[model samples]
Target: MKSLRACVAALAIATLGVLASPAAPAQAYPSPGIECYTIIDSNGNPQIHCIAVGALQEIDWCKGCPWAISFKDDIVFPETFDIDVIQGVENLSLAAAAADPRVAARFHDAAIADFASAARGLGKQTASPGPVGVYDTAHRKFVADNQSWLAAAGQDLADGLALLQKSFGSRDSAALVKAATAEFDEAFKEISGKQVIGG
Candidate 1:
């Protein structure tokens, strides 16, 4: 019986050690395939970074959510290509997921956590992102870089998401999804396109 008690004590200490470990180290934004971001690097050059966070419920949930881009200064576009079609939507709960409004808020809440967690996932922004309207240099470069494939407003990833919000509210986001398919299909054909996230 004393041996059994010793075993239990060992298990408890092991559990505590695992629980008290330090958090993950910091990294860059807009992980690959899962999500994308276009930015002006500190060197005055354009940088397209698409990175993926681990399946962290609190962090990754917000990182790839519908409202994710609202968190970053340089977060210009959403990777609508794989995000909606393959990876992102499976995790998110649309506001209009059900016909009942009573549950919509619950869905939205569970799918998209608050900004505090987002801040943790995105970390503090030290670099100053220059000019930022619709015609800003970063945006212009993102456009010019991907002009051949992602050229039009219809194919604009962020705009596609705007339409998506309305469609979800109406519970018929077919057009929203349809709007981006052909263009992204062509995007896949471009060089290093699987890893190249942009525009």
Candidate 2:
């Protein structure tokens, strides 16, 4: 009986060790407060905002990371369509152009010119009327409009990815992983309207 009890105790100890073993650190999920900003409405009402939807919570890093974005209830763009697609297109175009200089040069030049014009306009002190009849006195309105456009551009990229994955039968793990990472990076760039890091 004592031997049997000893064996049971050893088994219990083994089980406890397994349970207490450290798990691999989870992938960093987009927790709230990581990034935040605010926006104003047409009526000049200020609203607090978060890019993700729910109250941010940390999850196991080993599991897939999910992000939630939230905004004013009456936001002009719905959450589903807020991602920018044009940015992705621009990035993809630039990358392609880099590989083939001649074909990409014209597009790159046009993009640069457009960006330059906007920047120059922003640098000016006088306020100008924007498309929505809003006065761009401080250039705040101009920046916001540009930001919205970039977000739409990202959405476009996401759509492209969905289509590509569907058509290509992304069954190969390696290829699928590559494609997913690209899409995610592109989407992040579009939403943030910034250069992707570690690409």
Candidate 3:
């Protein structure tokens, strides 16, 4: 009878040990900081703003730190400003033109037409067909369908441009021209659904 009782106690102890083991850890969640600026239309008022991750430095939280600034509001310290990361539209135009003369000419014509149409559509906001209308065009349809791949290629071109700019400065017209050619080729390949012609 004692032996039977001892065996039962041992089994209970083993079961309790298994139950007390720690659970596996869960996956972590993304916590994005407000590092970029975006314009917001608040109550029919257009407001330019920058958001911060936390309270402002050397400022009391009780005073409402990291306050949102507006054009109508008083100027404050730690003002946010726009950084020209991609130079400007002028630079982009020149680069695009230098890269592929044919594509540049096409883009120029298309952009003018698109802008005029978009502006007209904007006047009648109800008429704006949005992405569907934009994708209706044959050229734009291909871009919409293969957006992810094209975006990756675009990023690659941007990175190459950044490298060239860093090493040779923006004055290196030759490098800029070369980078533009590469960008055009990438875009062409993406649009044509053809393998890259060369390395």
Q: Write the per-residue lDDT of candidate 2 for residues 24-56, one digit (tens) a residue.
A: 322222221222222233343323222321122
Number of the predicted model whose lDDT against the real structure is largest: 2
Query: Model 1, range 1-199, lDDT digits (tens) per residue?
Result: 0100000000001111111212332211122223233333223333333323221211221222211111123432222321232222221213222334545445434423221122122223211112111113323221112223222311232343333344443555566445433232232222112222445
Give the Cα lDDT of each candidate. Answer: 0.26, 0.29, 0.26
The C-alpha RMSD in Å for every predicted model, in order, reads 20.2, 23.4, 27.4
List candidate 1 segments past 4 Å from native: 1-38, 41-147, 150-159, 178-199
The candidate 2 region of ten consecutive residues with least summed lDDT is: 3-12
lDDT (10s digit) by residue, model 3, range 91-194:
33332333345555565444333222322322322111111001111121111222343344334433433433333334775666465445544533332231
Model 2 TM-score on a 0 to 1 scale: 0.24
Using all chains and alpha carbons, the TM-scores for the candidates as numbered come to 0.24, 0.24, 0.23
Query: Local error of candidate 2 at 61, Å?
Result: 37
| Candidates sorted by TM-score, best first | 2, 1, 3
